[model samples]
Target: MATTDTQPKRLPILTFCAGHMAVDWPHGAFWVLQPPIALAMGLSPSQMGLMVALTAVGATLSLLPAGMLSDHTRRRGPVFAGTFVWVVVGYGLASLAPDFWTLTLMLAIAGMGTSAWHPLATGTLTQTMAGQRARVLGIHAMGGTLAEVFAPLLTGVLLLYLDWREGLALAVIPAAVVGIIFFQARDRLTVETASAARLGDLKEMMQQWTSKTGLALVSMISIYNMAVMSVLAMATLYIVNDLGFSVFWGGVAFSAMILAGAVFQPIMGHLSDTMGRRKIFAISLFAAAPLGFAMPFIGSPWVAIGFLIVMIGAFYGVRSVVLASAVDFAGKREGTTLGLAFTLMDGVGALGAFLGGWAGDFDLAYAFALASGFAMISGTIALGSTLAFPKIQAEPAE
Candidate 1:
């Protein structure tokens, strides 16, 4: 946990963005790789479901303890570097996995590493300059979105030339290289820590999230995440199998979605600050519902790509705004709020993978319909909460 009173330097933000791009390189590939791995290993759809769910669940279960430990510890430099190292190790081990179970385990380990990233990075950025929270977070979110574009394109290319396991080894190299660089530049990136990152603050964390506004927003975010993650777990497979496209086309479609987010996330983040966050969030959810519902039926890959672009760009693009909203809700508990938000959103989101896989076992249309419905419900909840609360910043008591 780092701290600051004034505006933060740009180097640290760039460094975090670089690290984000590197780590998510492998993470973004996971979705693209799933279908091929399932085909090769003869896995059932539900078992395929376990791959993403367990990875997220592992991340979710481990987050609280890590979040607690990070709170009490003052040395964030090592924590940041260690996260990259953890990812490198996870991917390295994954490259050597002899079976599906081993591969899943390694991916889960990687998920744990990915889990620490947002809480550490977002907490620091949000604390650094209160005035620029949404924009900074948007830039940070953009880094992951860029990875979303690059990873599949790279992975899709790699699969044509190398063994899949060996291709996974490629992810380890860049991540480890970035980790070493971060270790060397750790001082420049460090921020001051607050006591809230304490090792025994479970009660405090619960108190912040238990309020009416908090519960409503969290529920909306959770359901929204479920819809997004479900699409992530299955979209590539749908494009490749249902639409009769090549693996490369699947990657292209996935990349299109991410590219849209990369381009629009910052703009939306900035917009959320000026417009009401609840309004932006609600609009995003509502706009995406119909797009998600129509994606599976589009038939043409190019047309389907348009659907994903709109959904990922317009619908799922509220990531930073929602995060800023959560920060507004947190007030003094920035670290605790970010950690809990990350954990709960992801933990609940993991269920979407399971549900998506289950539904996809039958028809992808069912999965898409489920996604559309969830999106509408999420938007509805956000709108109702906005009307009920009427205040964007529910600052906790001092």
Candidate 2:
């Protein structure tokens, strides 16, 4: 279990939202640039898949430790701010990579920086803002979703004047500024922990996660992430490579997928608070399943673009809700639980990205279809595990 302040402090939702945006910006920017980078390097789909998978590997390496550190640390500001700087430095160097393998290594390093923020920040958010978990998590998610919505389009516009490397370099500027702000303001981000992170805590967390209910929850979220991550990695390629769109249009397409999430994340978060995480999650997944399955079959780019909007909109907030639910089960170990949840999500998601990339080699449409199937499977898992999820108490009518 983790510690908490006796007198709750005012939630720094906006500050953390900014942090979330800064953390996610590089990730979204790099993802959209993959098609152009691959073309420039004369890389195949499999190699791209490997790069995405390795990036996930980098994230997994840091996520758990960061989460545990958050649980034990008295002041989280330095870690939080430092992770932001880490992202800036990693991605900035990635921009200067001279070769494919070097580029992959740099990107993986950046991935580590990007992923480390989640446990420190999200764990704090969930623990401190426990009562309104869904709503706050939703708002928090909007920050990242906003970055996801904008990064691709911004990178695309930049690509008009600069090469992919320059675009990558340019994207880190805002994050660098944000990182400096976080570091300077580190004192305010303190969370007093009752106990230090220990071997027993780690053993308990591992055992709990490996338990029947824990494994079920983990499997459901992991499968859902597989669908979401694979699509995120493949959609831009589908637009640029298969749809005959320019890199700018690929940016447009990728940004469009996340646009609704920025608007709907908080709303869905509120609904999840009042309605229930499991129900809303299942609805979102079920709704997205068909849309994703049908995307590859759509011949017109315009229609496919529309489908992307609706499908992704339905998928919006699902991750936030999932995170909130996992925290609900954490008792006092919110940070450790988040670390485990995120690790499972990205680790399994790595496999999906790898396999999806291979499928893209044959046909991007096939990857999209496969992602749809994963969504369906995940939704079914959610629906079946009513007993596994914590029961929600709907908020009173306002």
Candidate 3:
């Protein structure tokens, strides 16, 4: 009989990471590409804004179910399978969509795919890496940041040569390929181990939520999401409509912000490991709050671009630290804890998005200012909570 090598495989991890990056690419691409779609479909600003809102709403609604499935099954196959089908079919349908209503439905389908990836991928990484959870998660999140950088630039180039429909349709090819790769890797993803008892996962997650550390981290996530989403959803519009920049250049500005995020996330993750969470966490949040408030004060387009880079860098850098803190507080129930924390925070962030959109309707500067205000409140909460929790040493890598 042939003996199978006992050595662990890295291909599965690579496949999972690449699949995530592929799907996220379109998240940023959609924002840059939406204007062209709106023009083609004759959608009003309110209608377009509602479409963006639905994307978040759909993702938010799906998180709980997705988390439960990943935890109970301890299998990522179904999650990967579901995400792949939806991305391909959803975007394919979007390409052929005849009107706004159909496009909305298609986007909601795509949102389900996007929603499924997070809990499952994060859970798998948490289990696989064991003691090295923070570093691994940081690496995984870097994929998202990198996608944010590439998506708009790629989509902008595609839009120049093709219409929006065809450009969207082209996304289907990569989705199909990744789906196949995920299926092949499914057997390799068998759960290596779990940190906590399955029966107590929910109770444990709930208990953590009440802890000062958990509450602080959750609050930090909420504020970070609000600030990030407000800028992400509106930055393209602000550049084109308010700053008198071309769509191409607007995409360039957005890419610059994500580029900064990509560089800083890993640095913050390393800091979280070496420097201690409380100090780094407090400094990042406090620094980001003021930068967020200063966003509207920039006078020229170039200055505005610089402000975006600084603001997004600080915002995303702190977010990386906050997520690492969640792993620290969650103890053995990292997956379930992360799911619950993300669900609560994202749910609140969804409300923030609606508020931002409404505020933007009145005035763009006013909307951003509202986001800044929320960030300040969240930073204050995080500062206090950090003092209450006990410091824990970083776990060793498996």
lDDT of 1 at 129: 70
Residues 1-398, candidate 1: write the lDDT tens digits. Answer: 23342226644788788888887778887767876787888987667877888888787755665555444555567888988988888878887887878888888887788788777777777777778788898999888888889888888888777666766778667678888998997766655556644434677657767889779989888888888777777778778878787777788788988888788788888888887787888888787789878765776767776777787677557888778888888675565577777776788888988898899899865676787788788888888987798785642111
Root-mean-square deviation of every model: 3.1, 3.2, 3.4
lDDT for each residue of candidate 3 in 111-150, tens digit (9 for 90 to 100) = 6777677777777677657555656777787777777787
Give every collision pair in model 3: none
Best by TM-score: 2
Q: Indicate the TM-score of model 1.
A: 0.93
Per-residue lDDT of candidate 2, residues 1-398 (tens digit): 13333324554679888888888898889878998899899988778888888888777889989999989997887888889888889999999998889998898888888888888888787777778877777888888888888999999999898899998988887788888888888777877687987999999877877877777778888998888777777888888888899989889888888987677778777887777777788888887788778876798988887887777777765788788778765666778888888898898888888888998899887777888898888888877777554552232221
Q: Scored by Cα lDDT, where does model 1 land?
A: 0.77
Order the candidates by lDDT, highest first: 2, 1, 3
